[model samples]
Target: MSRVFVKKASYDNLDQLIAEIFTLYDINLRGKRVLIKPNMLGAFPPEHGNCTDPRLVAAVVREVRKQTDRIWVGDNPMRVQAGGGVDDSARISGIYEASQGYYVNVGAKARVISIGSEIIAQMPVSEYFLEADAIINLPKAKTHMIAGITCCVKNMFGAVVGSAKAKIHYDAGHAKRFTQFLVDLYKYFKPTLNIVEALTIMEGDGPTHGKIREGGKIIAGTSGVEVDAVVASMMGFQLNRLKFLQLASQAGLGECDLGKIEVVGDFEPWPNFELPSTYSGRPMDNIQVAQAAEIHEVWGQVGRLHPRFIEENCTACGSCAEICPAGAIALDPYPVVDEAKCVSCFCCAEVCPEAALVMPKEEAQTLFLRLNPQIREG
Candidate 1:
């Protein structure tokens, strides 16, 4: 039976909780190559809940250091070929300081690994993941625009290096198929342990731009799927509608049923937690979205994941254009994107410094358009 351990904790009190996890479980990390993969969704600070808390990461490293000297913390940041690499995110998010010089640039080197799935057969994984004997995944408990909830299962997407991610997303254009791809990825590159950083969680539009909520909890488990199941349930997500969790459960990856999982500590669910808007209109019983053309053909002739530029927030950094896999974005007087060429991968948004690229839901955009009659008329 899979066990999910919930520890009531704040960033300051993480040591005790981490200690409990080690004491509770029979995990052996002594003298082994360990990779600490944190939820590094670009380069946002811990308080924003956009990425994994550096404090939590440092704490994990300290604990892991007690057992092994061969430990490295790394993540392949969502950037274009010319933009900042993992170190930039590490420096910005304070993860580099937390890593204490063991930080690695995941995109620096990679080894292609097979997902063993027909949808996405081969992918280049970060060398850290390939090299590690034991992986300790520290994912932030936050709602993602794409996968719904980016916990244990979704965090593994960082394994695929740089622009290759865009290709993978392009492959799984439909939301449901993309969710299944995540499950398959997790199942392929399964983490040894998962500890969720939920002290400050992202509530509204996230894995990046969102509102912060203080749920004040730390969740841990041996199986990534089981930990995510408990966390998703705690966040008041209906399992039937949550495609990632449902797919993971259906794949026999881990037990999503609350009855099957053993909760080790007190769990308080966030009833009013605001989920993202990607839940509706996805891969259904008959919807076939295998090609990019199908995406534009599906919803009002525009792709589901539309990358819109927030003019006020944009500083003309040209990072978006530089990083766009399709070269759909061009830096004119501002940034002009060729919608037809864009794959809706959200990489441009991921690398932006000013949080300028906001991918609002289609309905939300329509409502905004309605509010501004001039823009609507134009």
Candidate 2:
């Protein structure tokens, strides 16, 4: 059984928190190549809770550096422009300064190499990630509009660099199929540890577009799926509902069953947090398909779906491209989703920081019917 160490901590002092985390996980950073992958989803501020807190990451760096001088940190931001590249080295330096340590963008400095054969293009990645001896994944725990939740596994997607990421989503296009891609990625880059930041989790249309909840919790584990399974349980959701988690488990990557895992530290239930109505619109299910059809109809009308982009609000960041595992989106003049390619995953809409993208109520209703075809009966 994998061991997961969870602790209740406040932001006032992160040094003590970092020490407790390292001790519980039994991580020896001294003289080890430590690659810290932060959830820098975008160039958003810490207050927004859209990305991993730099302060938290800095604390991790300080502790790890004590064990070794070889500390590398970085992540592939959704849509990074030339000047504002994915590295965002400044933010990294700021955190290290606070902790009395320094860091660098490992991805930027390190060379990119191909992983496996490219389904669409040549020179696909996995090598740069594999080069690291020890990897520390820092993922922000948040509700996802699709795939249920974005925790450790989803964070690994950023390991794929450049336009190659966009190309993969174009190839896969379906949630189930895209999930297979995630499993493949996980198999390629298995991290030594996963540390989840649930101090402030997002809900509703999230992984990006959601209200923040003060979960005030941190979970660390050797098994990535083990950590996410616990996060899902805290949210009162089943592990089965999370497609990535299920895929990971099926691939023999990690365990999602809470009953089989050992959790240390504060193991009490979460403070009964609730997902916002916008995100929790379809909880009703029935044993019979015919009976379930009734629930689908109500949900269909309420949860319509057609991608809507508010031009004024859009930054054209192309996060939608990165999260679209199906590779449906292309960053043309603006973001465009090939309907034939879109699987209604809404990962694009979910990761939009400006709330620039939206799904129309009517279209969502139609999608709901298609997803639950039996409910289309008159």
Q: List clash counts for every candidate, in order.
A: 0, 10
The TM-scores, one per candidate, come to: 0.86, 0.79
lDDT of 1 by residue, 1-378 (tens): 778888788778887779789777777898799999997776666556688889999999988888998988987766635366667778888898999778888778889878687678788888878888988999999876656678999888888888787767767665556767888888877888899998888865576676788878899988898898888788766565466776788888888788888887888788666665443222122111122222322443332456777899887878888777677888876788888887666767667777788666655334332333332242
lDDT of 2: 0.65
Q: What Cα-based lDDT does every candidate model obtain?
A: 0.74, 0.65
Candidate number achieving the greatest TM-score relative to the actual structure: 1
| After superposition, candidate 2 runs with Cα above 4 Å error | 81-84, 88-102, 106-123, 126-128, 268-279, 282-305, 311-352, 360-378
Give the per-residue Cα lDDT of candidate 1 at 254: 80
- The lDDT, on a scale of 0 to 1, for candidate 1 is 0.74
Error of 1 at 340 (Å): 2.7
